[model samples]
Target: MSDPIPSADPLDDLRALIRGAPGPDRGAVAAARARDAELTKPAGSLGRLEEIVEWLAAWQGRTPPAIHHPLVAVFAANHGVAERGVSAYPASVTKQMVANFAAGGAAINQICIAEDISLKVFELALDVPTPDITVADAFDRTGFVATVAFGMEAISGGIDLLCLGEMGIANTTVAAAVHYALYGGSAEDWVGRGTGVDDEGLARKRAAVEAAVARLDGERDGLEVLRHVGGREIAAMAGAILAARHQRIPVIVDGYVTTAAAAALHAIDPHAIDHCLFSHLSVEPGHRRVLERLGVKPLLDLGLRLGEGTGAALAAGIVKSAVRIHAGMATFSSAGVSERGVH
Candidate 1:
């Protein structure tokens, strides 16, 4: 068999990103759990959320989960299918929303600020052909690889964790198409009322996806399918996830669109899933299907549909709590308590 596709090494780039902080420490997690058990609460009283925090603590290799340099990366793009009226909002909304994120006016902005997380934005052109999109599209494969390689590498440095958000009008349509191509599901299974599409708009969105799938029939390669129907932001997010895994940094994924992108990435490299955490269940029809296929239970289920990493950003708190409990809760032996259930 031919050699497997090679991904860049992220450790060196991470060293530069973090200025040399060590990766997570297993020992710190043990110490933190001991402290947590001593806090006078029943063992696991905090429930699964506490367990999540404990895991985060272990992931961070720190007793207490820290957000000193938390990072939220938002990728924006426009889809050609939006030209067919698949989304309730116009394609222009993609660029406009990117502006909203830059100005700190979107839901993700508020949540990230509230959580004290640093946010960065990247533009990848999957379909839209505007001049700005041209500049964003200038990166060739090597450049694209390096950009993701460096971005993931840098974000992993001293950065406690990473969250991914996406903005692209009609992006859900692109996501659905990618989902269909990768998973062989009907467009009905993957399409949803993106950005509040009305019944007529929803029908059009589904048709567009179906049309895209029919057009690409017989082509099963993930990258080829993405090129045929995927959006730039979707591709960039995939690259970001790959980079995160390379750096051993955990990534919290947002809603349907991001999940679709992730599905495509997983098709390319199954190992990428190891570093991902599903943030929430989107009310969007396709979101749950993709999550189910991924075999990941999201941390939250608030009927959320907004993209831009809002769900993941909100879920970060739950992850922090889990890490806290994992690192802080006391083990049975550490608490000086005798086992009561033993024969």
Candidate 2:
């Protein structure tokens, strides 16, 4: 399954980079933390901001890191399970929302505009959806490779912070299935009311996820689990996270669906987690379990369940401000202020 060249196999390239990806620069992290202590504000006064700055420094391999150009990629794809009434909205909404995102009409578009961050929607096409996870592999190998490459190409140069988002109907079901596959659990433990599914719909969603989890018999440590339960967009987000870490760009993971991709990516390479910042802990029941397993804390918790990278865009500003403060603020020595506890 490992192809040496990109032409032979695309997924191989991703796997290759992820396997070889280096750990974050510890020297940069130490220097950034040292700088944070010298800031005019009290040590650790900025709370998460201080941690964010250090994260940016280590990921970018530089101290005083700055979020020069923030970019959010909203990977959109359809799920075959959606045809089974898991989501409240029709599957057509996935394609329609992609147009809305393109036309600058969605909430994420407006958020990107307000924050001055670029936004792009990667619609994996509505005509061809991933197979139902309950029966067959959710994604084709070739298409999965293409989606990952597409995500990598979307990320060009001059990108400081990478925010990952998704737009797919019934994706929470897909996410829950992957979650259950990754970590053994009951359907009730992983399922959530995605898109505000009614009681009966939620029950159906859990049943579908449970069935999907039961169908897995492949190698647990390989990509078989993801291929069986992950959608193209989810695969692409995993690729993007891998690509971001391969490039040493710090990535901000959105909500449950995005975190699911992060989870899948982490399964492949635990080292990649060092570059990821969980934007928020989603209300989705399974998200907390994933976050806990990863041992990473979410930056914000505004009860955000909307999945158009809204949580990511909202967190992007805070991350940027952290860098700006770390880079632009004067030290107490420069400000001519007496050091704390100086007799």
Candidate 3:
């Protein structure tokens, strides 16, 4: 049978949407700031939250910002490297967790319901299988560019906002391996105690990363490392970020694995950074390094290590607050209050 034609590029579609989207109004910002100064509190007493609200207004190109149809897209998959005894959890956990997510038993499901945000899950052919996870358009390529390109094109939908998460056992090994290959560091530099792996398990995990790197020498680009050492979910997340940038939708990235994927995407297109929001700092040892490399400051640092978009889901509340404050707060003139804190 002939292969089916691919759909229109989501990134291109997104760019068109953003081009037509309105830019923030300076008049609205001035009014909002003035009203914020008079909001029955000391000027700037609300700290960064207040600033976040103002920034949201600007991002939405309105005096009062609103986020309509916010979306959280979770990508789940398993890693082939799990067979190497690198992770504390079994590969079955990937399928089980995905089932939990589908059944509303996962943290992300509950959070999304509580927050009233739309959630969609994709399963890449990393390891686990889910009926809902959409496959990428291109076949898996052995080389880097092809693999990254395949991943990037998979989920380029015109989502309003995106959150990246992964669910692969031993996938952290793949991330560390990618890091080692890209940074020329020892596995020890990127390895961590993923999912409560004991010291010996951690050592084994580190060895797996080193092995993957050694197995794919001279493959230095993001796509090649991804094909050789990256998980399917990671690759998909990288693609999703690229699509989000092309669509001009902000992407909220979860912990170490997802951030590593983001790094790969940024390597492909630096402009992608402008469309990203680092959600939280994960307790994973390598997460900080990855975020630092990306020059991103997360909105929160709650010592979280859960990988199923849990951190990003929690951080979504903050984004919601920013939107609400921007759209709901009264202006100084509207409230008949003096803008005494003008500076």
lDDT of 2 by residue, 246-278 (tens): 688999999999988888767777776689889
Better of 2 and 3 by TM-score: 2
Estimate, for each residue in 25-99, the C-alpha lDDT of model 1 and write its tens digit: 577667766666665466667776655655566555566665556688888876556667777887777778777
lDDT tens digits, residue span 138-231, model 3: 1235333433455556555544556677777777777787777777757788898888898889877877776667766556666555655676
Q: Which pairs clash in model 3?
A: 23-61, 24-61, 78-127, 123-133, 144-223, 144-224, 152-239
Superposed model 1: Cα runs more than 4 Å off: 1-40, 54-66, 125-157, 325-343
lDDT, candidate 3, residue 185?
A: 59
Evaluate model 1: give its lDDT. 0.69
Candidate 2: 10-residue stretch with minimal lDDT: 217-226
Error of 2 at 292 (Å): 0.7
Model 2 spans with C-alpha error above 4 angstroms? 1-14, 341-343
lDDT of 2: 0.84
lDDT of 1 at 153: 47
The lDDT of each candidate is: 0.69, 0.84, 0.67
The 10-residue segment with the lowest total lDDT in model 3: 130-139
